[model samples]
Target: MEETLHWQPAATHTELLAGPVAEAVRALADDDVHVAAIDPGLADTAAFCEKYGVALDESANCVIVAGKRGGEVRYAACMVLATMRADVNGVIRKRLDVRKSSFAPMAEAVELTGMEYGGITPLGLPADWPILVDSNVASHNRVVIGSGVRRSKLAVSGALLAGLKGAEVLDLATGA
Candidate 1:
């Protein structure tokens, strides 16, 4: 799958990424991270993998979840393989210590992360938001994820993602 796409150094192709995502790539300064341009209309996981010949398990999805308690709301990014769903109502709700937790609205997620709706990635999320990585994803050798823009995707080592500043690898996936 990696050889199927024309991969370029993410740090050098900032134009293909949303502002915050590009900045995050630059900050990481990791040469192994790569990016590939894709048709914006096919950015969704199913379409992308089918069109690009990538396997479902090789791609990770980043879901933005909002947890609310009283009048306070907190947001977090959950990274799980496309083959599994995040344990939102169970693990995440308890982790956030919130009474109610659900996927954040599209508009709220886009606005808060400064990333496009289908292109939100854990790499550049707000520093305060904890990035919950599914243990399966964290153990994978490589995985593709959104690049903060629908027109491109980032390819990175699972280990690198798990090592991000605020990332926490956990048993956050179910139905695998």
Candidate 2:
């Protein structure tokens, strides 16, 4: 892994990670993934990339969605490149087999995932929730994704993300 003075190292031995981030790091132990603390104010994709000298194309964004079928609610985490947007209504709704689907409310998403609104990631999500990764994201050699906290980020191989439990790579993104 590349070393940088700007980032603190993360591993099983480190316990500085936030709630959901710590769990994600532990869950991805077998993969060559790394996590680093970042300034919370710059955690958003555009700001993070610009401030860190990272390319927007190399970073992915995760969105939480709530789908309703009958009276029950189902959730899914959708990941796409920073350059694109997730097709929630067209792709996700059909795949989820739900009559209605939309972005989950911030409070509900944070409460359910145990992560901040801007930092909700696919990792450590509820086992029942599927993680839909865009095909472009899955094809990359490496990607920068949320660490389940606005204060940190995770770097991992696209294959590692594809191997995540409940992950399904599809054409989930569309040009904004």
Candidate 3:
């Protein structure tokens, strides 16, 4: 096996506090990456910032789901910030068009994302999935997201990140 990164580089996964967080750290890379752990669900991006001493704007939230309209099936995994919410009823619904749209269950989410229920990252998502990224994320120089586990997160630049992930940036998400 590789010796792994010895020092904290400019871009690499951080520490492993064990559990899902640890798994995420390993998932990010060998070194130069940093990982932060906080409350579960990562529902509160601001809180995560306070706890980890990382900028909220530099953090990213991974959104995953499946869309079905008639016999057509579309898998979408979006990465946005806590500042904005995905337009589930607007874009997602109209795009999927099943009379209604809702979030996928934990089991389905995990199965579809290939990442943990609470720690789904857009980086490693299935290539076929239509990764939607918000334009807002591009405003920020960098962002953070799950390393495939709720207990861990990885930071990366918005431009470099979205491009690397092959994400399609759009006004996909709208507000309530």
The model with the greatest TM-score is: 1
Ranking the candidates on TM-score from highest down gives: 1, 2, 3
lDDT of 1: 0.93
lDDT of candidate model 2 versus the reference: 0.81
Give the clashing residue pairs of candidate 1, or none. none
- Tens digits of per-residue lDDT for model 2, 79-131: 99999999999999998999989999999999999988787778788888899
Q: If both were scored by lDDT, which would come out higher, candidate 1 or candidate 3?
A: 1
* N/CA/C clash count, model 2: 0
Cα lDDT computed for each candidate against the true fold: 0.93, 0.81, 0.61
RMSD to the hidden true structure, all candidates: 1.8, 2.9, 6.7
Quantify how close model 2 is to the true structure by its C-alpha RMSD in Å.
Answer: 2.9
Residue by residue across 1-176, what tens digits does model 1's lDDT show?
33268999999999999999999999999998999999999999999999898999999999999988888999989999999999999999888889889999999999999999899999888999999999999999999999999999999999999999999999999986
Better of 1 and 2 by TM-score: 1
lDDT of 1 at 53: 89
Order of quality (lDDT): 1, 2, 3
Better candidate number, 1 or 3, judged by TM-score: 1
